[model samples]
Target: MVLVISVTVSFFWLWFIKRFETSTRLTGKPSVIFSLFLCGIGSVFAALFLAELEELLLSHVAFLSPLTYYVFYVGLCEEFGKFLVFYLAASLTDMTKEPKDGLLQAAAVALGFAILENILYSDWGLGILLLRSVMATTGHMSFAVIWGYAAGLYLYSKRAGKNKYSFGMVIGAVCTAAVFHGLYDYFLGMDLKPISFLLDAIVLSISVYILRSLKGRSPYESGDKEAVAEAIESNSNNFHLNRLAGVQALKTRDFETAAKYFKKASTVNHREISTKVCLLFTELLTGSVEEFEAYRTLDRICSSINVSNLNRLRARIAEVFAGCPDEERLLNLIDDLIDETGYRELLKERIAQFDKYANAIAGKGCADSGFLISDKNSLPMAYRHPSFYTKENNE
Candidate 1:
């Protein structure tokens, strides 16, 4: 009966954590489940190894405080064991592509550890089993979420090409989880009800906050249904994969294919301004001025578009206009900018510079004399009139 009760409670907690995986569409992979079980079995061995090490090392010490033992020996050992498995699973598996996946997989690992732990304590009676189910199992899950969120953030950052701080984030997450686990154990070992309750409350609050924040930033939450269907047809719903495809197409100068992928990505999440920008840029490169103009105008009108994105769009427009002499389109884009937002001053300065360059080229009758001339060192090579250089050579 005791074994039945223990197994039932363990499975229930596993089910609870697995729900997160299902919601994130991670349940389709059998490898992920297999990894979780391996981590669980590895955690059992880790526990045994740590016990032997602790017994050998602590026996040499003259005196050891209970708090020190709980924090360093018990807390550090257990948390490190779980973390090793978590890190291995994350590194080895292609399944952990998103932040939510990290959280789900970490939780799965924690559940596995908790199940083995529960089995070990099964003979402690029903009261202990019930207590462990509610406190220890939940505590393990909560602690894993902290580091899991960090791992997820690292993965997300790497995918976005902004991974400068990813290593720090991972380290900070692991340390923070270890400390929290240590404190929880220390407080519980002290046998003070009030202190333990206070620590539990803090841990629980942090876990809830982390989960909510990760959900809000989840990439799975965005994208159109049709786009998702297409991704499914292609056997991938990974946002990074789609974005990489678009990037590759762009690099190959296949503007149409790039535009197709970018458009699909834009539909994935309407709020992803960067994807929209890529689509708009692709349209500009393809000489689809009309499409570019429409997207620009719509982006300008949408209040949800922030100032930073507005500036990026303006810069891209400037680059395009500088490279190609399209007076009418340039005038229209400038007029739209003037009427739309607070970027009038910046636009005016850019126009002034462009006009100055054009005048210098026309007045000098020299291809190499003006700022409009393309130089290997200069970027977004300023616009040169197609005929200006030809006329200069004739003169």
Candidate 2:
């Protein structure tokens, strides 16, 4: 009965932490299940190996005090073991993409470790189970968060091309988590009830602080909009930054520059449908049909293009022009979208430009039609319409 309750409670805690993940769509159920299994196995082996080492050291090191052994040796072994599992999980999968994922996965590893530890300590009966459930298990999780936050920052920096900073963060995170874990054990090992309780409170408080801080910094949070925007603006290699810049450039009819940025963004994260679509359009407009064809072969954008869906329409137009297999069907789809959405006039204008550019590319080449302008002054007359591609007056 006690074992059942403990396991159930531990799993509940896992579920609770997972519930707050930033994006379930990004971290699917299968990934979570796999992580839980791997971490659980890792924790069991880590415990067995550490147990042997502990006995060997105790026999040889006569001068070592209980406090010293608990703080340095025991704490280091446990924390380092948990961290290894966490690091492996982070590196092996896309599960650690966001800050919240780092926190959640780190917590998952600690919980898995604690669950086995709890089962072993269960011989002490219900009181031990209750105490371990609330304090010991939670303590492991709390300490893990320090490293988890660092793991998240590392991944974020790596994506943003801050390699040196990310490497430093990884080292710092491991050290911090180990130190905290050691300190927590050292306090409890003292066996002084009042002091131990006070230290527990302090440790718990710090854990809560870390959790709240990571949550606030999550990219998916509405309150962190400014932070996300800042990341996009400042990080040149950042996918969001490149995507936004490409969109702005496209709006101003800078097809060449827009294509360059969108291509970069797509390269960084190919799964992005919008970026793929925009890149295709910009490439086609700039008369890079062969290059565009190669890009399409890299990934098939299967989503339907709706006239009412401005973004998808842009991509569909690019698809139609790029000679997608179902070119006739796509054109019919566009016609239906235009008719249904009452955007006939706008569609007609865009279609006219597309036809003109196509004819020019077939005859004089893409560069002569002004689709691939090498300089601002070389922009074609058709694309220079003030109401359309001209950004100065519009802005």
Candidate 3:
């Protein structure tokens, strides 16, 4: 009976996982295979535990009396064993990049154990097998999920240098698992007594709570890009669209247009130091070095006081352009400026420009026209408009 149940349960769990892993739309073969391998190892260890129950109980200090402690023993041993296997598996494979992947792998391990354990129980027939696959398998999957989530969180926290209290999480997971395992066993050991339903409810609630935490507490929140967009929208009242237009012009290699847009944006208003430096670059590239001196006539034109050497470097690069008409020297200076400050607006502009016109210095290698730029050409018009490009009139 146990044998038949194990075979059926394992097949179903494996099929479920195969679908779930595929549905994620992930392409790598190694992570998928490693997750399955974790499941198989978990099953074998569970079968070994069942085979040597007496020795296991002794090692666990479980005398089958005061059943709470017995459940705790089982929980501790099982949780710790699964942790060891997961750690070893992770060390051996390169598939553990994302947080959600760890939990999936843990579920595989837990399901494997449940399937094997169902097979070993002597009294279980087809009817029992069905119940075990649903109830028992689900229980094991839930338990595994708790630790799998922990593994994900720990890895994420470690990567970020934020989990100084990670050791506590292991203790917390094992103890939580023990509580749920104890409640389930206590009800089952009571042989379906009427009050057992209430205990079962409690167990379900606890399991649900752990699963919810895992779902919500994944290391990398999936919608970060959307979140950033929301923040930008929320602050739209304070954002200057004209300034952004200038940055766009510089990116498309329209230096003359960029100069006009930056001039207008700088004269009207600005705060970001990045905006000031970018405006200077535009002015320099349009062959208007003397205009840089125009800033001395006003108290200030932009909010970000230019960086100490930023203007000097721009001026030096202007001289390089003036001395030999060498675009290479000027471009090198611009690239150096981008690397030193790590400002992404410039890089993002270049990428967007390359994507659009396919003629900018940066756009040389791109092959896809549809991917390059939209037919509307909003970027070009946005930079050239007087409302966006003519700064001195606004000031």
Candidate 4:
């Protein structure tokens, strides 16, 4: 059961990261990935050794304050332990060559530490176990993100013969990670009311944001025209994992998970049209865009003529476009496909091309297209009038 939970939690994150890594220049080599995992496990022992040393020094020496001790010792020790493993991984494998690679490997190492920590804490009870899986694991990974990105940046810049500043940035990043980690644990141990939780939330939120933003800076994100081409170039086994996961979830109509997987795939290659169609299909149909302002994103790409990017999911695309009630304004934009023909003719041709359009909706009612940028785009004035709204704006 312990092994099961560890694999389920850690490997899920690994798979998601692997999907994102598909668009990177790395091969996503399993040798380095699992090697980091094993090193992460071993790092727990390293932390234990460091802790013993810390206790010995604390017993003899005095510290300025409780917070300072935690920051200088507890946080420093734990983070440094992980850093030792990352250093080891870099030395032994070719994995840590890129900044993004550093971030992903950092996650792998953090997961290994989390898994081992989870095993040690399993006797505490299911509640703590579950809580640790999410919060503690996230905290561990979140802290590592800083140092990992820094280390990666150092390697990247050094290789490119660019900035010498990244080396200092790495040291600063590790210190920053240690400070946050120390403060986080210090607050948790102090058990202050909202302060602890608030700080934890801020740290985790910032880490999550950094992870997302770094994806665009990935070297593979050279704005390549083809979606699968990125994966094809990398030749990663995890290529299309997100797309396939989305399809499986879509088959079961598990819109939530399908949305997550498709979103992951899009992060890998935003220009990839197939994932965009499925993601838009699910996000709209589920009304997830209601509060998400997905409309702004939709309008941003209204003039896009990548409809021809549809490849394998022709039947799925047909099914979605034929029946999505939320796409009324999208239909309007489709009708305005200036370079393409009429919506119906396009649908007919699409049907001929993809076996058939599964289900077609012809009801003429104004969909709150602006709910997700339905009418707020620069795709020409083809659908300002509802009568002109075409039904072809679908997956």
User: Each prediction's TM-score against the native?
Assistant: 0.55, 0.57, 0.47, 0.53
- Tell me model 1's lDDT, rounded to 2 decimals: 0.62
lDDT of 4 by residue, 1-395 (tens): 64576568777777766666633333334446666777898888887888898788778675558798779887888888898888777756545434577887887788788889888988988877876776677778778888988887776555445665556787788889989888887877787626766766787687667777776655445322233333333333333656765665666667887798788778887777656867876787677665235544544444344444322234446555554454465444333343243454555554343221111211322233222222233334453333343554542
- Number of clashes in every candidate structure? 1, 0, 3, 3
Give the C-alpha miss distance for residue 140 in model 3, angstroms. Answer: 0.7
lDDT of 1 by residue, 1-395 (tens): 65566557656766665555533353234537536855865776786687688879778788878777776777667776777777776666555555666776777777778778877887888877777766777787778778877786676456545573467777777677777777887877677757776776778688777767656654444433333333334334544446546665665577787788777767765666656656666676678857557545554544454446566765654543343334355435544544444443344455566656655555443344334434322433333332222222434
**Best by the lDDT measure:** 4
Model 1 has how many clashing residue pairs? 1
Top TM-score: which candidate number?
2
Q: How accurate is candidate 2 locally (lDDT)?
A: 0.63
If the candidates were sorted by their lDDT against the true structure, best first, what order would they fall in? 4, 2, 1, 3
Question: In candidate 4, where is summed lDDT lowest over 10 consecutive residues?
Answer: 356-365
Report, for every candidate in turn, its global Cα lDDT versus the true structure.
0.62, 0.63, 0.53, 0.64
In candidate 2, what are the lDDT values of residues 1-395, reduced to their tens digit? Answer: 76777677677777767656755543233547336535855775775687577778677676877666666677777877777777776677655555567677777888888888888888887887877776777777777777777776677566556553556776677677667666666766666646656666676687678777777776545335444544553344557656766665655567787788889888988877667766765665677766436344323463234445644555545542454344454344334434533443454466467557765555444654446533433556555452353223335
Q: Which is superior by lDDT, 1 or 4?
A: 4
**Model 3: what TM-score?**
0.47
Q: Give candidates' CA RMSD values in order.
A: 19.6, 15.1, 17.6, 18.1
Reference-based lDDT, residue 7, model 4: 63
